[model samples]
Target chain A: MDYIRVILTIFWKDILAERRTREILSAMLVFALVVILLFVFAFDLSPETRRNTAAGVIWVTLCFSGTIGLNRTLSVEKDRGGIDGLMLAPADRTALFFGKALTNWVYMLLTALFVVPIYSLFNNTNLFSFTLLGVIMLGTFGYIVTGTLLSSLSLQLRSREMLLPVLLFPVVIPLLLSAIRATSILLEGGSQTELNTWLVLLFSYDLIFLAISVMVFDKIIED
Target chain B: MRNSTKTSLMLIVVDILAASLILTALFMVFYYAPVEVEMGLVQKIFYFHVAAAWTGMLGFLVALAAGIGLLRSGNMKWDIAGVAGVEIGLVFISLSTIMGSIWARPIWNTWWTWDPRLSTALIMMLIYFAYLLLRNGVEEPGRRARFSAVYAIVGFVSVPLTFLSIRLFRTIHPVIIGSSDPAATGVFEMSTRMTHTFMISLVAFSVLFVALFWHRVRLGVKLALFEQRKMEDFTGED
Candidate 1:
């Protein structure tokens, strides 16, 4: 019950701040839309040509915009001493992880939500499939699980803004690649078997890192 | 200070053993390994190629273990060992990757193929290269050790997943002679003498790896001590 409260409190905190500023979400949404526009011009992708290429463009946009929000979100905490205050709280460390992860997940998903409608309007293609949304959830789960921890660590470093992506992109390639591949399968209208294998892999990855970070995060966060 | 001579002696013996085994393995590969009528001399490269990769994997796994050990125990020496293992692993894996490429060029008809295993090996190499870069960016010893240890452990865990995911992707490279598939792609039969030579090469390379790792560890220890002693000298603390 207490853990649930902490998570909700943290989630509410992030939401209120974002509501006040509207900076992070706006930047992420615009960035994602521009990327879609770039994809149209760069590939000469007509509506007819967009179906096959849509999944890749959407994922790429999410990854880039998601990274921007992640960096800014954590930087806000660090700058305002909010992270230090959270550390002083007498609760479990994993709660903090869950809280941050939940909020970041929300930010990424919300970005995707906006991106999808804009993409559909611009490209005139439907991306509202159940299977594709499932892929996004699982993929974004894996991505943010690693990204939240990485962004926290990168915030401590000197070249933080630049370092987060460098430290992250290579390590998280398995998630991104698997997710993209799995998403591609769903977008192609393939059966569950084709999607099941990669989904299983993503589930296992999320489990492994979730456990590891929960255990070791206290160590990393120690002064 | 007194251990330097003994360490050097051990390194020499290991190097000599590695040299003999490599030469004998080459001779047996040419004469006794029984080249396939298909791949001819090119297939001979597979023995050392696989061995180097295995050894590199061994080095990486140990480094990861040492990194975790350092973090848990807070022992500076384990941190040194972790760094040494990663450096040597990086070197051997580089050799393995280059040799794999050379072998692949003739066999696969290209300098590189997105063959799953080979691609994983290349990506793993890049991950550690970033590992070294991370270490370089940190100035404080304690912080560097802690951060690098965390990275090594996380990075190592991700390696197998990366390889498995790629292998799951699609594989075109043939399983070699001694691997599981008897009728696998690029498969061939090996004679007794060739087996003997390959075993010797494995043993020799194992010795060489230990020798190199130990020397590198010693260098790390000495450097740490040097930094500490320099700090003490400046402070006039006995």
Candidate 2:
């Protein structure tokens, strides 16, 4: 009960903060739109090629633009001294970790919400199937889980703005790989076993890293 | 303070062992190992190529273990061990990658393929490069050690998935010395001499890894001591 409250409190605070500014969400959305256009021009997508490349475009756009939001997730808190205040509060720190991850996860999901429809509109392909949306949710969870944890670590470093993606990208490659392949499978109506395997991969990835991040978040947050 | 005792007796022994073992392995690879009927001369590169990949994997494993050590014990020496492991791992992995690329040019008809193994190797290098950069970004020793250990653990978690993902994803890399995949290319059957040469090469590279790892750890110790002294210098007389 207490843990949930602390988490919700932070979540609410972040929501309020983001609502007031909407800076992170707007940046992510605009960047995602540009990436979609860039992909269309770069790949010279035909209807056939568009279906093949849509997964890559959607995932890459979310991956890159979400990075912009993730970089700010922690740095904004630290920059405003909110991190120190939260840490000093007599609340469970792991709860705070969850709250921040939850907020970022929501931001990424929202970004996908916008990007997926817009990508469909631009590419003139339907990408909003139930299974594809599920993949998006699973993939975004894994991505934000990692992005938030790593942003916490990177935020305290020198030249942190430039350092976040370098630190985060390698770690998330497997997730992206699975996500992209799974998206392709969904879009192309690939075999069930193939989809199951990538789903299992994404689920296991989310589980393992989530547990590891929770266990180690203490060490990272301790001043 | 510089290293005392001029040369450690153990280092001299390691140097001699590594040199002799590597030379013998090279001789075995070139002169002893029977050339495969199919890839001919280029097949010889397979020996050192495997050896270098083995050593590279060994280096990252050392870093991973050392990371666990640091997290559990909170010791600076563990950080030194971790740094030494990653630096050596990055260099040898790059070498292995180059060798693989060279082999691919002849065998696979391209200098590179978007194969899982190749991409994984490249990604591993990027992860460790980030590891080194992360360590360099922090001036405080404790924070640097803790953060890098965390990153190492996180980075290593992705490696096996590259292998696992390949099951659903097709690859053209040769399925050498393991379960046969008909889809694989560059297949070879190792004859008796090839087997012996391969074994010796593996052993020799293991020895070389140990020698280089130890040397790096020693240098790391000296650097830490030097840094400590420099820090002490900044404060006029405590």
Candidate 3:
């Protein structure tokens, strides 16, 4: 209960702060839209092809914008001297990990909420399936679960914004591959077995990395 | 610095051994092994190519252990080992990729394909390369080691998952160890002579990887010491 309360406090603080500025959320939304726009131009994302190409485009957009959101979320804390204050507080450090991850997870889902509709509208293809949205949600959860830790790890490094993506992209290749593939199957419709493979892979990824990050995150953020 | 000369002497001995073994393996690969029937001379690349890729993977595995060692012990010595393993891994893996690419050109009639093994090799390269870049991004030595160690573990764990996801898609890369894929372009069975050459190449590469790991660790130590001394001597002078 204490751990949960501490995590919620930090999560609440982040949400309140973000609500005021909406900087991270807005940035992610706009960036995601632009990436979709780029994909529209670069690839023939007509109604027929949208099923195959849109899955990758959407995930890539989420990843890139998610990177931006992750960097800023941490930098905002560092810039405001919130990190030292948080450290001094009488809370379990891992609570802070959950707090940050939870917040990023929200922002990422919010970004996805916006991108999916816009994509469906532009392509004239219905992407409003419950399963597709569920896949998006699951994939986003895994991405942020892994990204939150990495963004924190890379946060303290020089040229951190530049460093974050390079640090992150390789580590999440599996997650990205699974997410894109899973979404494609949901959109285009595929064999239940293949979908099961990717969804299980995605779930295991979320679980495995979430455990690893919680164990080691304190090392990165510790004084 | 006290044991620098002694260590250098050891490095020289191992270096000589590695060089000679590789030379013998090279001779056996070309001269002793029968010319591959289907691919002829081009198939010769398979020996060193696989060896380099194996050594590269061995280096990364060493780094994973070094990473764990550093986290558990808080020893910076393990940091040197971690960096050295990754550095050597990076070089060798990149060589393996290029060599594999060249082999693909003739054998697969394409410069590249996203077969599970090939893509996995590429992702492995990127992951370790990012490991090196992460090291460069942190100014504090202890923190850098800790961060990179964390990442090395993370990166190492993700690779197999990456492999599994891609493998599920379908692999056209040859599986020489197990049953080969029929759809795979360049599958081959090794004759006795070729197997002998391949085994020798593997041995040669293992020795070379170990020797290089030690040498790289030594060089890392020297570089760290030099940097520390230089930092100490600096007094904010122009």
Candidate 4:
């Protein structure tokens, strides 16, 4: 379908651009590393404390670094007038939203992929579980679904840099709370019963936000 | 001219009613309602605290409706209503949070807890604070209205989620009128007089919310007109 192609075209364009510049990924990765390092010195937790708190630390780092990637994802388009160019393309605007959100979601997952192993090695706690990774993916998807839409809105503002997180963080609290809880439960070796509610919360958040972002993205992008 | 006078007269009547009702509600809270035995006089904060929280939620619902209105009709009046609702919502939510904190200090023995209701209320406040900031960051009125309306629409999705997540996950905050939870530290059974006072206070605050929102919308309309006139003058000079 043309819609699928349009979405993929936008997605591939971002991929190609990032593959050439590597700007967003590099910044997000470095920011993730620094946040983790700062957490190390700030908390100075013992092994037991570290085990319990590792999930919180990782999610927080991902959230902070994820903001960087999101800011870049849209600001880059706005800075170069790429959004106007994309708008000129005869495609549904929702496709553009899906494309951008998908790209941001990928960037977030890639950052997590790198951050998780390094965090595990440094903290001496295994965080590479499938369940935790699943939570990260769902959480990151929900966050980016909202984030990409908000970043687009913020990019049109004078205070785009500061506005994105202010707009995004408060709205994403449900996703964050559920994600953190699920991750903590996995880290503590909790059974499925404890994780079920959180997983449902994350799924519902993703669905709700994805639907809203698609519906409202057109209004924000209008000239 | 006659229509303007009529509208102003209605507003004045509403203002007088709001004032008297608020005074009566305060009297009922202090003099009429039974003093709570467990927490003593400090428990009196619950009357206004709950009232303010309900008003804040009502304001947000108004904002959400106005947001949808703007998107549907593309009218600046709807945008004006949207901003007014958010502004008033922010004020009452902030009041509720602070009063809840003060009440918590004595009852829960801590100034703060990660109680679901309290945390969600704080998050709701932060979302609207961001809404205000988002509006400030735009200079163009039309674009600003569009962006803020869209943000309000998107932002409202969080309210229900925040409430549900808190209710589902864990809560130590008191559920005032519901099934008794033994773990809820602040649960209190209300006598008939107390219930009457609470209902009156809720009604009074709802009227206050409407009055404040109307005034704010009027101010927004005037500001928009003034800005348009200023732009026209600048264009004329050019």
Candidate 5:
């Protein structure tokens, strides 16, 4: 279908652009690493404490670094007048939203993939587990879905850099809380019953925001 | 001019009604409701605390409705109502949080705890604060309204999920009048007079919310009109 092609075209365009420059990914990765290092010194945890706090540290890092990627990606589009170009394309606006959100999700996942290994190395906790990965995927999906939508709005603002997180963090609390709980449980070998609720919460949040952002995308991007 | 006078008259009538009801509710809370035996006078904050919180929720619902209105109709009046609701809601939520904290110190032995309701309310406050900030950062009127309405709807949709996640994860806040939760800490029985006072206070606060919302909307209308007139004058000169 033309819609599918449109979405993929946008996705591939971002991939090609990133492959060329590596600007957004590099900034996100570096910022993520710095946050982890800062947390390491700030907490100064023992092995036992590290095991308990590792989930918190990873999420906090992702959240802060994720903001960098989101702000930069959207602002680039705005800066180059790429959004106007996309608008003039012969495609449904929702397809454009999907394309951007999918690319954003890939960026977030890639950041998490890089962060997890480095985090495990630093903390001596093997975070490369199936369960933790699942939570990270769901959390990152919800985060980027909402973040991409908000960043589009924020990019048009006078204080785009500061405005994104202010608009984002609070709305993303449920997703973050659920992710943290599930991650902590997996790390600590907690019972399955305890983890199930948080997983469900994450799924519900993803569904709700995904549907909302899709429906409202056309409205916000209207010239 | 006729419409303005009519609106002013209606506002005056609503103002008197809100004022008298609030005063009567205060009288009932202080005089009619029996002093809570265990928490003593500190428990009196409960009537106003709960009332302010109800008003806050009401204000948010107004914003939600106004958000939908704006999206459906593309009218600036809906945008005005949306902003007015959020501003008033912010004030009342702040009041409720402060008063709840004041009540919590004696009851919970801590200034604050991560009780599900308290935490969700805090997050709600932050979200709306960001809403106001988002509105402030935009320059163009139409674009600002469109962006803000979308954000308001998005933010409103997230609130229930936020509350649900917190409530399911951990809950120590009391369910005052409803479900029986053995784990809830602050549960207390209300006497008949206390119930009466609570109900009256809720009604009074709802009326106050309406009056304040209408006043705020009028202010927004006046602001928009002044800006429009100024722009017209400048354009005419050109």
Candidate 6:
């Protein structure tokens, strides 16, 4: 119960901070929008082509934007000594992990929330599909889970900003690949049978990585 | 002193054993192991190639375990061992990847395929190579150990994911080279003589892993001791 409060409190603090400053979200949003625009020009795809490739474009953009958001979010805590205070509090390290992950998830999702409507308007496509949202949610969950833990680990280092991607991208490639493929299938109006295997693969990936992160996270933060 | 003597004696025995094992494995592979209907002579490289990869993974797992042990106990010696294991693992991974490439040239006709195992091996190599770089980037001994330990632990998870990530793209891929059942790969058949040779080679490689690990650990201890002495000298505390 206390752990829940701690997590919520941390989450709220992060939310309030972002609301006041709008640093992370603004950067992420602009970056994502730019990436989408670049994809539009570079690929020169028709509507059908864009729809098919939209999943990949969105995910690649999210991954890049997500990394930026995570770095800024953690940097905020580290810079303001907020994380130190949080650590000093009577909260479990897992709570901190969860709190940060949740906050980052919301930020990422919010970025998506803002991104999708604009994407639909600009591309003149329907990204408002419930299935696409489902893919984004599931995909973002795995990304934030792994990304938050790695950001924490990297925060304690000197070349932290650069180190996070180096440590993360290789490990997280499976998530990106699975999410993109699943999303692409859905966007193409594929039947459930066509998407079933990828959905299972995505869920299993999220579960396996979440479990491993939970097991090792204590060691990571024990300093 | 006594430990060094024993280690040196063990090294001699291990050297002899490894030589005999490699030769016997080679002999059996060429003379006894049946040629594959599909891959022919190139399939022979799979034995040594996969053996190298397996040993590399074994070394990586050991490094991860040692990393956890060091953190739990706060022992620098365990940290030293962890670094040594990762370095040796890096070497073996490189050997395996190169051998895989060599074999791929004749078999896959491209000298490379983005095959899952090969791709994963490449990722493992980069992760650990980055592990070493991360260490070099830090100046503090304590912080270096902590960071490297975390990196090693995190890096191991990628090994499996990299090896299998392609399967999510499609399940048409076969994990024949490292499967538990030989028939699954359908590319190679091992006679009894071949099996004997493989066992010998496995044992030999395991010994080599230990010897190399021990030597690296000794170097780490010596370096640490030297630092300690230099610090003491600087402070004039001795």
Alpha-carbon deviation at A169 in model 2, angstroms: 1.1
lDDT of 3 by residue, A73-165 (tens): 788889889899888878888888888888888888888889989988987767878888788888888888788899998888887678888
lDDT of 2 by residue, A8-56 (tens): 8998998899899989999999998999898888878889989987888
The runs of at least 3 residues in candidate 3 whose Cα sits more than 4 Å from the true structure, single-residue gaps closed, are B1-6, B161-169, B235-238
lDDT comparison, 2 vs 6, better candidate? 2
Q: Candidates' DockQ values?
A: 0.56, 0.83, 0.79, 0.83, 0.86, 0.50
Error of 1 at B95 (Å): 1.6
Kindly list the per-residue Cα lDDT of model 1 for residues A103-123, writing each as its tens digit.
Answer: 889999999899887888886
Where is model 5 more than 4 Å wrong at Cα? B161-169
lDDT of 1 at B169: 52
| C-alpha root-mean-square deviation, candidate 5 | 1.5
- Candidate 1 CAPRI grade: medium
TM-score of chain B of each: 0.86, 0.93, 0.92, 0.95, 0.94, 0.84
Q: What is the lDDT, from 0 to 100, of the residue A209 in candidate 6? A: 69
Candidate that beats the other on lDDT, 1 or 5, i.e. the better one: 5
Residue B10, candidate 5: alpha-carbon lDDT: 97
TM-scores of the candidates in the order shown: 0.92, 0.95, 0.95, 0.97, 0.97, 0.88
| Candidate 5 residue-wise lDDT, A34-95, digit = tens | 99898888878888898888889889899999998888777888889898899999989989
Top candidate on DockQ is 5
Candidate 3 chain A, poorest ten consecutive residues by summed lDDT: A43-52
lDDT of 1 by residue, B126-226 (tens): 87887887787776688778878877877786567543533355466554442433222455566676577667667766777887787788799999999
lDDT of 6 by residue, B7-62 (tens): 78987787776677777777777887777678777777777776777778888888
